[model samples]
Target: MARAFCSSDDEVRRVQSALDEAQAGRARTLAAFAVTVGSDGAVAGLLGLNEREVRVARRTVGKDDAHRVAEALWERSRLDRQPAPQDGTPEPDSTAYPNEAPAQPGPTPHVAGQAGEPESSPAVDAVLTGAWHTGADLTTLAAELGLDPDFLAARAQQLAAEGRLTPTPAPDHTGRHRRMVEGPPPPADETTYLHWHQPAPQSPHHQHVSWEQQPPVTWGTPVTAPQHAWDGYLSHGQYSGTTS
Candidate 1:
């Protein structure tokens, strides 16, 4: 006998209704041979399977066929509905689903060489130099050099926070204590000045004698470019000058 299983309009509800009718041994909307095809290609409805048998198999029997029927009914119901607005306001070059907004790119950091303002500064140079040459922490180095630790830390932290300095972690309490990590060296207060070596002048090996008893002698070729020359001189193992 021909019977309407379930229509797309009310596929699931209709199938369930039929199942109920069959279980109760009442009139069934779905026939024994009628079947429903879901949007996903699952099959619902029954053919040759009696009402009571189908009910038992689907409800009490818990057969896979019952599950297939439910899935089929759902899928077919969704597919049979009117086509959704495939192209809202006419499709653009790109196809986007309805209710979806265009994607936006994230903001990028302002690089030094780019059109943005220059990021280089004397403070930044000092922090970087301290970190490289001495392997010192930014905050500790700045403090040791009598600089504002906050300002120095900011510059160094910028590089670190940006993941550029992934090799080095940020300065913490531990890093601050590392200021003295260089270890003890010769004290700067030592006043002893002893001459180590002197290069002969390219000239006639000029020698000058003072008439004054034990005339004071200048040291180290009279150091012309004296940038931190005093510190450099002090660092020398032996310092030499007229011991007046």
Candidate 2:
């Protein structure tokens, strides 16, 4: 009889398959253990344990080694047909728990448009005070702040609840207009002008803000007239060589 010899390639493939199966088993065991531990034993984010600590914990199981322990317990329970507890509550299934998320620290506060950092409470006040006078409506204010109007309104409502802002009185009993309260007084009078940018369009909602009306002013700031005064700039070709 000829002796049978296994090829090296076949042996290598067999070993690789075994390793793959083992990894899959370990993954399943870990999943089961995580769920079994429930919220109390589940730690948020990655375990900060060092390699040596992890090795020791793996050998001598601790609270953090719930998955491995759960796997062993499950195997014994299934093999022995262990009696269920009298209370009839099911033992936790570690497989159900998801990987914990990383912890987030508290918010970082700063002033907006200053040093390129978002403004904190005081900075928010300063920006708003300088932003609109004749009291800007919430939508206009939100546009100036580069935020969505609805988002700004929600924030405004929250602030109002906290006594930081006040909701404007209903325009009519029927509630036609919904405006936010005026922000804090500016450092100077509201009439004082800052550099006027190009006039915004005069839509029906914005008609009150017109060229004849002084540009909206912040408190403590004097309105400065533009150097070249023109009511409205006209195109050059539009007026070319036409008799007066």
Candidate 3:
């Protein structure tokens, strides 16, 4: 074997490859990052350039140094978009910071009935109300809030059942977002109605009860019918005799 003076380029590449693999496993996807920063164009825009100059990678596999550097910028943008505590929405995780989200990315996702039931909380209700009124994307909002989209969606259904929201919000085919809601669920009115028809009076010879026209009945309500008298006899279109 001949000895030759050579740099550690081969060893360096091997170690660098391992490092890249480890970081890639921990890092968020480019699409996820783009959502935080607005869009693929936005991630590149942070470099004082537009989409035409540098198109943000849609996937993570082929990302270059620019995408890696853009992570810090994307994280900051996400934080800036967080709902302020004073706004009544649940605050983002305090431990989350730029480029440090890998350790703690907001609160652990809640799947409504899985981790815990989706109880109606004031903070959640406020967020749902604002989203409905302002036409916000529920899935994106949930992500920003560090919540499981399904959990937030289940919460919306619970709110609707409790008469808080008018129409229930549903995810589209892709589950990327929820259908728009116009307003809080309309107030459900409770009503009680009584409907009955007295049978036509008959002469002493025949005794039979015939129901007259009854009032229109609404669905999902109780209807009552009274008893019919047997001894009553009709005379001149009126009951003429009374029974003891």
Candidate 4:
């Protein structure tokens, strides 16, 4: 039997052009899916192109690269439909390249305890309210509310779809990289001390008396004295009048 070839170069170019135009238009999700399907670097080997080139092609939607990818996908699909040879030779598997279709972008999936469900309660409403007022990101809000980020994101998307919440655009972090922060060392000349208060012991005579009937206790302020004052106190059993 004659081998079936893939689409012609002109046909692939026409399809790719259509896809590019659609991608630029409102069908952005479909365009992204088409380009990203079977995008696991292995497509480079199948198309006899380098991985970098394949990546560049996917990003820019280059005509040549698109044609090559489309041809590979078509061949893969054809191989999948073809049966084994009469001689009992196994057919080639086209799924060797990851061609998994992306999920259709539309209404969020129904989740337990999500909006519109019986499980939805005041807590959900409060979270949605806080999210509206603070404009916090999903991860931060999830952490603060002790909820899953994925669940929060999905719920937010659902609310946005329902016209109850406005979706905020993610911040652009292009060309921004994280760096380690080194704090300054502590001061060497400063002397620090910690003070703790000990509760007064109960007197034998007042052992039966409640705390409310006890006399008021006094607390003393800590002061730093000069070295001369300490020496005088140690020698005379009394502090000197001088203080620094």
Candidate 5:
């Protein structure tokens, strides 16, 4: 029994050694094919294995699965290297399998405000023109220009400072009265009065009246007729001594 177990172990080692040699040879072949065509990812996808598994299969020995992966990679490389159809049509055999032929990448689509392209120039011009002629604020102009309001406001301020654009004027608040805090009413004993003062003398020949020396004549104040002779001459229907 001991001799038989030893013989079985030796046979297993021999078979494993043979598999290691075959796997190493297949890995070398697959590596060459991978260099010629696509990367480990493409080859792994063709073999239905993940990238890590494919890499491990390439390195580790005694893996019959690696041989199968190697064969698939070799075939894929040959197909990729084949000449394109002369008539600009896809080769019939190339489309036999879904992923047999890699699709040619198309040009990327353009996005507004992309890094390389300058989209702000025309936008800034439109905003400035609208602001100057229409007197529209940054929020309204941003909506019209389809731009960010904050960005538009900042740009508008910069342009206005540079004298490239005129900023919209702030709304007038002159007549808009705000509510004032009410203070305590005036003292009850205090009397408020409206007074009418006498007009200055209009004639150059007459002496000028100095109003600063006279007290203001209130509503109930009395007036006496002038003693001068000119007072009768000056008394006309239009002239009234009483203050209205």
Candidate 6:
């Protein structure tokens, strides 16, 4: 019995803007899902997104049931790619008949529920385990695996740090060693810092989250929730939050 209505041109414009934003977000999310299943660099390049954005989208998707939906979609695609008798189509001839044409082997397509090594990336991967061939050119290996050498090296190091990978005769350590560590700029001289209105430092919880996390901020702190809330709102946290 009710009809939707728009009040004014401004309201219509706002609705249209919101819809546009929603559509862009949907595209980004789908691109991110594609990234999760062997399409990382391709989807990232197509959508003009960097690895962090792709990873963030993937993590966001994992926070809900959407990841399962993506996995289902992958399975469906796998099924469609396989030879099957669907829609009354004839099943592929797998038997070696005496007179039939010999099966020509081509690059194998990726298949789920199978143990076959993928044609795209070699299955016997040892880069992450720090067991790739000694004196092997990892940059070339990364290219072959469609990965960045830096990332491969970093993951191996991380795994080693976690004691999951053994550092056998160590690979060459390069990138992280070269990165510069810069501390914050000098604190604008104490007088200038005092003159400027600085936001009170908040516990890490308050700025980014709301609802239960807001009242929820102090759940881990020894201080009471009221005290935490009071501290968070009273410009007591770090001097970075926007002021009213």
**Highest-lDDT candidate:** 5
Q: In terms of TM-score, which candidate is strongest?
A: 5
Q: Candidate 4 versus the native: TM-score? A: 0.20
Tell me the whole-model lDDT of each prediction, alpha carbons only: 0.43, 0.44, 0.50, 0.51, 0.53, 0.50
**1-244 per-residue lDDT for model 2 (tens digits):** 1223457667889999999888655545544444464432342234443444333333344454556557777789897886668789876666565554445687888533335343336655544434322344544555677755444333333444455443233223221122113344445443544323344545875665453464343233332221011101111212121121
TM-score (C-alpha, index-matched) for candidate 1 = 0.17
**What RMSD does each model have against the real structure?**
23.1, 32.8, 37.2, 38.5, 27.5, 48.7
TM-scores for all candidates: the values are 0.17, 0.19, 0.22, 0.20, 0.23, 0.21
In candidate 2, how many Å is residue 57 off? 18
Q: Write out the backbone clash pairs for model 1.
A: 32-47, 39-75, 39-76, 194-239, 194-240, 195-239, 195-240
**91-165 in candidate 5: lDDT tens per residue?**
588558878778889998865443643355865766565655454444455567676654554454545456665
lDDT of 4 at 150: 49
Deviation of model 4 at 29, angstroms? 99
> Which regions of candidate 3 are displaced past 4 Å?
1-112, 116-120, 167-244
Per-residue C-alpha lDDT of model 1 across residues 145-227, encoded as one tens digit per residue: 66554444445555544544333233333322253453443443434322223434434423433222342332212222222
Worst 10 residues of 4 by lDDT: 174-183
So what's the TM-score on candidate 6? 0.21
Model 3, residue 14: distance off in Å is 99
What C-alpha lDDT, on a 0 to 100 scale, does residue 172 get in candidate 4? Answer: 36
lDDT of 3 by residue, 86-177 (tens): 96876677566656555646797754465464455689888976665444555567669877665666565566557665433332342112
**Once superposed on the true structure, which residue ranges of model 1 sit more than 4 Å away at CA?**
1-123, 129-134, 137-140, 168-244
Off by over 4 Å in 6: 1-6, 9-21, 24-28, 31-35, 38-42, 63-66, 72-244
> Clashes in each model (backbone N, CA, C under 3 Å)?
7, 16, 3, 0, 0, 10
Sorted on TM-score, highest at the top, how do the candidates line up? 5, 3, 6, 4, 2, 1
